[model samples]
Target: MKAFDWQLQKNGYIPMSGQIVDASLVSAPKQRNTEVEKEAIKAGKTGREIWPNEPNKAAQKDMDARWTLKMGGKIRYRSDGTSLPQIALPVFGYKSHIAVDRRFGFIRESALTSAVQADGRMLPRLVTTGNTSSGVWADSAYRSQKNETGLALRMLVSRIHRRKPAGKPMPHNIVRANAAKSAIRAHVEHVFAHQKNRFGLFIRTIGIARAMAKLILANIAYNFDRLVFHQRA
Candidate 1:
């Protein structure tokens, strides 16, 4: 596949997506729920069936075909860099656009949205990827000078249209205003990590759009889970 060049505008966003499923619904032959794994070990049914195998037929097929649709991308680290791998599940897939508060792990504003791209769109998603209600932030992968010129122009137009009230400042000042809006909107990484670490869930699908949907659902579920747990405690 041909790779495309991307850039991160001073103001960009990173949209996130995920999925949630019942532990019993995944079809892996060696599937072992952590709860089941412990019980089976106690019953002397202990085997490698509980944990995932790299070469198992079920694992390989699921990994290739359904993982992304079911699970969604998970963050991982390698010798080279970090990767978002798939996690499998049943029923729902969620795609969310979040903007975070840079000074804290709070979400400023977010839209629970859906994606139309199989591999997903580069700019629309990234430019809106944050929990901030103000501006956006993203990496170089989301921005490009050539292919995304139209989108860039659109964003510029939108920014201009949303410019501050009259008797305020000039365009450059508004640019700086947008930049400042993004200043407190840089905490998405920690939010992503919290979602991953707390849920122990990640992407597991091969279909890109389905995977994106799965991701969105997970975030919604995570928030609800926290609310419920915190209330009881």
Candidate 2:
């Protein structure tokens, strides 16, 4: 349920179309050895460097395939903001995706798991857990989906008409409540923008492992700023 800005790139691991292929791989030759090592780890097999009949490229490819499939594919935006292909990377090397609240703010939830369009399943769960009485505010990402995977969304709609008392068709109260809730939640979106804009996080790095470590350092610094000076100021 950790939250952080992310970057996307094509042929990142191995360039798809470009001279350099990717930033990290292109930046230094030392990275070549690192890639070999990473491939070894990702494969879950031992390396031949220190043993016989140990794990090799074949083993790594097998393990990498499992992870690669789950990752889906490359995500790109057209000149007009339309998504070229629906591929997306798992944010922050996290197993499960992030848990963003109704305001698009970060929420720490364990139920959130990694999958295609994870928020589709997450939003409703959060709402249901919070109970539908207070109403939940959300963005287009949550509303754009046609199916309701999370129970949160259903509970919310039910809470609104619970009293129907008579046969009053639904009420506008739900709309009003969501509007108010959204106004406050919108700040969470800003939180994301602020982090990514300040840090060069919108682009993939030379290595996912190094990129992840840097991301952790960045978050630590960010939290420190808020705790030490921003909060007190």
Candidate 3:
């Protein structure tokens, strides 16, 4: 699938415009663990090694999957304008980090890792200097001083959303900058939404290898569908 995408780029079919980076959680079935078992595992009495010893029980547990929490999109407001507690839902599975071309919304690069992995840590692998020379747009999750320095090293403009300091509202200039960056970064979400909604891009597979294969195929399929739509239009 990656080879095909690269061929398209090599043939000048897909433009290498600025790239937008983002990640989405692909939920896997929650691994069932009893309270006692959970405590045993935490205390090091039981470990992943037990799974290999019991194939039947191991089948119920996804050895490769990990748990992570995803934040609710909006903060609920009460009648008096007090914000309700933000809910973070437990999701077990993997994260799909993708770089999409800004011009055609094609998936240019991708990396899959456990859901618990930090999105920023995978940015260097998902993005490349060759394609991102123009710029790279991403949300706050991908922002950090280290990432800013890395971007500068690659000679790429950092359009990542700035993180406001703790306990203080963002300065007006930074807020406006984020708004402008979001206008361009939001296009990346369209590819993810199409895959999730139209193609049902969810991981039913157990291991990282299977999950990654599924996501890569889906990305290739999405690029083909996008190409067809553009040609038709």
Clashes of each: 48, 5, 0
**Local error of candidate 2 at residue 62 (angstroms):** 16
Worst ten-residue run, lDDT, model 3?
A: 40-49
Ranking by TM-score: 3, 2, 1
Q: Candidate 2, residues 1-233: lDDT per residue as tens digits?
A: 13322211121211111010000001111212355566665556544442345555433321211122233544344545455556444232222222333322232232312122344445544442432133444443455334232334454331111221122333568556555555555544443454456754432333344444544554444444433442365
- The RMSD (Cα, Å) of candidate 3 is 3.3
Clashing pairs in 3: none
The C-alpha lDDT values of all candidates are 0.37, 0.35, 0.81
RMSD, each candidate, Å? 16.9, 14.8, 3.3
**Candidate 2 residue spans exceeding 4 A from truth:** 1-118, 123-137, 143-172, 206-215
Q: Mind giving the per-residue lDDT tens digits that candidate 3 earns over 200-228? A: 88788877788889998999899899888
lDDT of 1 by residue, 1-233 (tens): 00101111122312132111011111222332366544654454424454446335333322112212444553344434334355754533333445433332333333332221122233353333232232334432233444245445544222211233334433576557556534433345545556667765554663334554565566556544534554476
Is candidate 1 or 2 superior in lDDT? 1
